[model samples]
Target: MNVFYEEDGGFKVGAVLADNTTSLQVEAPHGKRSKIKAGTVLLKFEKPALSEFMEQAQHVADELDADFLWECSNQDEFGFADLGLEYFGHAPSTVEAAGLLIKLHGSPMHFYKKGKGHYKAAPEESLKAALASVERKRLQALQQAEYTAQLTGFSCPEALLPQINMLLYRPDKNTIEYKALEQACHDTGLTPPKLLEKCGAIPSSHDYHFNAFLFEHFPKGIEFGEIGEFDIPQDLPESNVSAFSIDDATTTEIDDAFSLIHLPNGNWQVGIHIAAPALGFGPGSRLDEIALERLSTVYMPGNKITMLPDALVNAYTLEATKSCPALSMYLEIESADYSVVSSVTRIERVKIAANLRHDTLEPLFNEDTLARGGPDYPFKKELGILWELANRLEIGRGKQGSNIGTDYSFVVKDDRIAITDRKRGNPIDKVVSELMIYVNSRWAKMLSEKGVAGVFRSQFNGKVRLSTTPGKHIGLGVDQYAWASSPLRRSMDLLNQRQLIALVRGEPAPYASNSEVLLGAVSDFELASEAYNSFQRNMERYWCLRYVLQEGINEASATVLKENLIRLDTLPLVTRVPSMPELPPGTQVQVALSNVELLDLAFGCEFKHRIELQ
Candidate 1:
């Protein structure tokens, strides 16, 4: 047979190449004696390279349903040259035809239907089946559109498109659809109960799936912008506390909120307002079960899927008002050393008069206006007291051998996230943070000492490997430390909270809770943290790439930190010293960000190439 040897020296047989090149023809030994023309049939690669290899290759081509020619030889050195072969009534140059053959041959030849070529795999019948399925789906959707149009008396295809899309795209899940159905019924004044009854009693459907369904019914009326703004109804029956916020952007259901009270006892009474998620998302619902599966809320940059719904989270369960039940941890400590001379942990109700963030209050500190307002006097006074307490406590902890983790802060400027090394730490922020840490640490220790079954949240002391005895908590600068602060985080904290609650209530601890489960939970937490770090690092790389292309200089002082990672001083704000590489310590380099595929060894992340200068 005429064979065309590829660059890799693989043979392809055809009378007239797919590219209509006669010079690139593959003809059989028998066909060489006969006058072979364009469109001549030949055997494909069928046999393995070891036995009748050409025939095996022909068999593969036959499997792809390719029309192969026999013994049609090419004149080119690579046996890929095309002869004068007519293709679709147009005869192109032999070289051009050969080039085209090479192009088709080199491309994913396996993508074509089987019996075509060895590279051209898979059965043609399977492809036809896949196409038929798509066609059937399209036809079914068209029929549904027609039916829907008739019922609604809508003639426009634009109007019908949404309905058809939803019928075909809506998920099989029921609960999500139930929620959407309820929303649609409320919005369109349709009978939701009757409609739900007509459909099998499905409990939940995914939000996107249900939304797609609604889009089908009222494509024009459905506002896409409003779909993302998932606000729960506030008119629902009030519980002990209600969700109140001026804007949707700032409102998030978090475990804790802090309010400051200037107490006569000298130390400020800082109220930690945490949403009781366990109360609403307890035992039964599929959501609760899923929450148990995941354990905590993980905030990835591009996405945030909350553990609890806004209803329980932002509303009923969170500590919003003075009457909301809370467990107050009051510490009467010296503001100079952050030493807790006296402390009281009480289970009671509290009011968070102000829910503030560092960003929100930081500007106010600059203006000195918050302290001027009489209503904000208490907040200001408490903030002052808290800051003093926090600094002293922070110092005291350091003295006690606690490793304070590195703080990497950043800000969103002009839609791009920029890393900032600004010393933005405020006394007020520190005060609240330190107070919480102190209380959380104390509770963790209390539970651990009491031999209670609870989860421990501690960082390993720079040790790479997992071992029986993990060294000091380096970040905390402590010989050992754990957390029991944020119960709303995951069941780990919840378990710890329950233990602390039992201790406070003078009840015996439930020792039946498995240690294995706690360890498993710890392992999960580590995995989740790693995932978060990976996501953040990826975004950082993207931003750094953009910076290099737009603002960064071509020649930046770089130090090869690791084998592949080279740390470049891109911004003047960065205070950390350069990392040492195996090569000459601080080797200057003219580096550009080149897209490099992340290897399995390097983790599934793209690397920023650093070209070192000699």
Candidate 2:
């Protein structure tokens, strides 16, 4: 006898081998044998074979109308055979009963299973809603297919234009645009950015990278609207010294400058003046809030997003010919030796005499010119005096200047670039760097002595950190150092400047010790500053490759940094040269560059011959 039974909540047919009272030993159609309970047995037939019965029942199930079956089903639960009998208007054959069971099992939405071979009809409302959802999804699948077809042909669908940033930077996988973009990427083996660029969706390669950064960092866009008007301080005592700033020609928000006064007592009074914007913008003010959100100015190869608006920067920046409010550190150094006899910090208006550009001044005043007594130039006398003091300050630090290697300044204009190479520890660099370091260290000391809290830059054991407590910055060979000079560009500098101004003016400090705002700003600035610096380095690297392609540098020399890593001689670029022979660091090797991908910001560097042996 052939029996139809349920096993593991599924229908199966097996041949009974030995029948017991309540159980049977049966062999399945595939010849596997098992003991079964009598209660699990649904039917027993003698005529048709088990294999043919299932195949014929499936055909009948295919022919059945699920909607019609659902309508014909009784509201209360009934067995499949009873429903089959009700629909067929007769006592169902065993095959017909099994076909009804198959139909009911297939249409889960139309019918819900209650017990073995027993079924219940779904409610009309739920059935309609489920059908509508399935139909909508089916239509969306068809639309996705159409969009993919358009993208496959290098044509962007109109629907994807609105979601270009989303598709490139942060895609929502559930949306149809992203689905089509993913499918197109899989088909073409091209990245989404490349595919979109091919379809003319991306206008420029520069914008592609710029927009990605903006989307992640400046989601609302880099705009400062209606932050209120800024007031330039009018009632400030003007200084006698005429100051001049040294920065790149493109710099507009000039921060630090210098001045000199010959005292009658054979001592030189030198002023390291910093543009003081903190005096204008207090904590929780509009400009302060904007500066807080920005944290620091974002710099790339050719452009920058300033922490302050142009109007405010123009007012506060120590522009030439303007008597601007500044926080000055006047150092009284004896003429016989460049030692700080005394130092004073005060807030006053200092006349900015000139804005010296590196391109113009570097030629007149450099290491060679300083050693040989330069051909006459603007601020030559003042710079020479300051250069002496800078050297003295460097000697006081117990080290030469922070000498590493070469530093490149990038200038980009209308897609053209110029990268000027300069040595790190030149006279121009030393003078500016040493004075800034001295003032930062001196002001850090003053703030600590006065019981004022300030954000200090501390380094120990090769790791750098921001802390409130005064500690030794072993790198600079200083007891403590804080950034208080560049308030026009950096928020932390602005914060420290606020504290220093309070201490110098004998006013209550703005931030209390261990205040949440102070602590949070320290940590937040570290994270934001690191991210901005990394982005600047990466963008500079991208430009280096662009320079390679533009200059057609096919073969170049590089010094080995590690096993396979090399630093190019002409460009500030580091890469892994392929198939490099084992060599020690500082061994120069010739390399061939090829396959520069701007979008990927990568280069294929091949090892040539060793340029410098052992």
Candidate 3:
């Protein structure tokens, strides 16, 4: 006998092979045998063949209107056979019962299944809401298909334009737009940024990379909000000597300056004057909070986000002709050997006599010019004296002060980039670096000696870190180096300056021994400083690639660092050449450049020939 049964939420017709009261062994129309419960068997028939039963039943189910069937049923639960009998106005045929069951099971919005074959009509309101949801989903599917087509066709829909950054940076996976973009990316074998760029959604590659960084790091935006002003300190004593600053022309946050005074005992009193923003605001102040949040000034090739507001930077930066409040460290050096005889730290306002720029000063103050000692310029004598003292300080620290390699500086103007290289350990660099290192080391030693907590930059076993505890910075050849010089640029410097100020004033230290605040600042500053430096490096790399493209150069010179890895000679760019032949490290080579992808910050290159050293 043929039996119509419900299995796995569907109706099927099978021929019974062995019949049991509780369960039956039946062979389906496809000749597949399965064991079924007797309760799951909804109907028993004999006339129609098993193959013909389901097809005919499905036709009948399709012909029936589910809404009409729902309307005909009562609110109380009833079996499908009973409903079919009531609707057909007769003892229902097996096919009619199976078809009605099929319709009732399929149209869940109209009727909800209760038991094996029993069903109940859905409530009016619930059925309407369910139907509306289905319709909305259907429409959304169509819209998603449309967006997918547009994206795959290299056209961005207007709806997706406003959300381009969001889609690229932080995507909501559940949205249809994101799903469409995801599908398009999969179809085109491209990333979200590449696909968006293809669709004309990305106007500038530079902005794309820059904006992604901003989105991740500065989610609230780079602009400083309504931090109420604080008064600049006015009661500080002014220093007797005039100070001069040497920095790049682009520098506006003039952190550290220098002063020279000839003392009576044939000695020189050299002052390392640091711009003291800590004087204007103390711990827990609004400005302090701002500085702590930013941690350090974020620098790129052509731009920077200052740690403090422009107004505060202006008030504190030791600009030329301004008597800026400074945390000055004075070292009395005996003229015979340029050795420090005594050292003292004080809070004073120092007159900035000049802001010497590297571009102007390097021409007159470099190694060759200093050795010749003929071409004289403003502050040349002071710079010479400082150079001598810097040498003495370097020698005292047991450092040979070797020039490792070239340091590249990038200047961007009107979408054009100029990458210039300066040899490391130049006299200007040595003087500034040595003095800053000395001052930082001195302040850190003072803080440690006074039992005050401060953030220090320490290096041990080739690893560098920030800590409240004092340790040796083997790289700088210093016992303990706290960043107390660039108070206008770094949060650690500012915090260290505060501790040093309190210690020098004989007042209670703002951060006590093992203070959580100091420790937390060290941890937080390390993380932020690394992130800022990485961003700076990436932006520098971006501009290096920009400079290459801007100059329309095809062939370039490179020094191989490892197998297939090369650094460009003219710019600070490092890339791999897959087509390059195996070569040793430091081998110079000529390479042909092609396919520069700014979005990916990558390029394709082929090695041409080895360049022999002169």
What lDDT does the true structure give each of the candidates?
0.44, 0.89, 0.89
Residue 266 lDDT (model 2): 88
Per-residue lDDT tens digits for candidate 3, residues 27-118, read 98778999999998889999577788877788889999987888899899998888888899997788877778888888999998899888
Backbone clash count for every predicted candidate, in the order shown: 69, 0, 0
Q: In model 1, where do residues sit more than 4 Å from their true spots? A: 1-251, 262-273, 281-288, 316-323, 335-338, 364-378, 399-421, 424-429, 459-461, 464-474, 508-516, 543-565, 568-614
List TM-score per model, in order. Answer: 0.49, 0.95, 0.96
Best by TM-score: 3
Q: Which stretches of candidate 3 lie over 4 Å from their true place?
A: none
Ordered from best to worst TM-score, the candidate numbers read 3, 2, 1
lDDT of 1 by residue, 1-614 (tens): 23323322343343333334443344433454223333333223322222344454444333432222211322222222222142213553332333334433533321331222222322446546765777787776666545443333322233323333343345342333333444444544545333332332222322233333235433453222221222223232222222211111233554555555445666545444444443333333554444455566544323344544444455434434434444556655554454666666655444445455555565454324534543443246555556556667777677432433233343435645555443334444455466667766676666666666555545664543221122345555544444555565565665566556667778875433465545665676667656545545554444444444445334455554545445555532111223323454454443433332121111122233335555
Worst 10 residues of 2 by lDDT: 225-234
Candidate 1: lDDT of 287? 45
The stretch of ten residues in a row with the least summed lDDT in candidate 1 is 597-606
lDDT comparison, 1 vs 3, better candidate: 3
Q: Write the residue-wise lDDT of candidate 2 on 250-359 in tens digits.
A: 99889999999899998999999999998787888899889888999999989999999998898899999999999999999988888999999889999999999888
Q: lDDT of candidate 3? A: 0.89
RMSD over all Cα atoms, model 2:
2.1
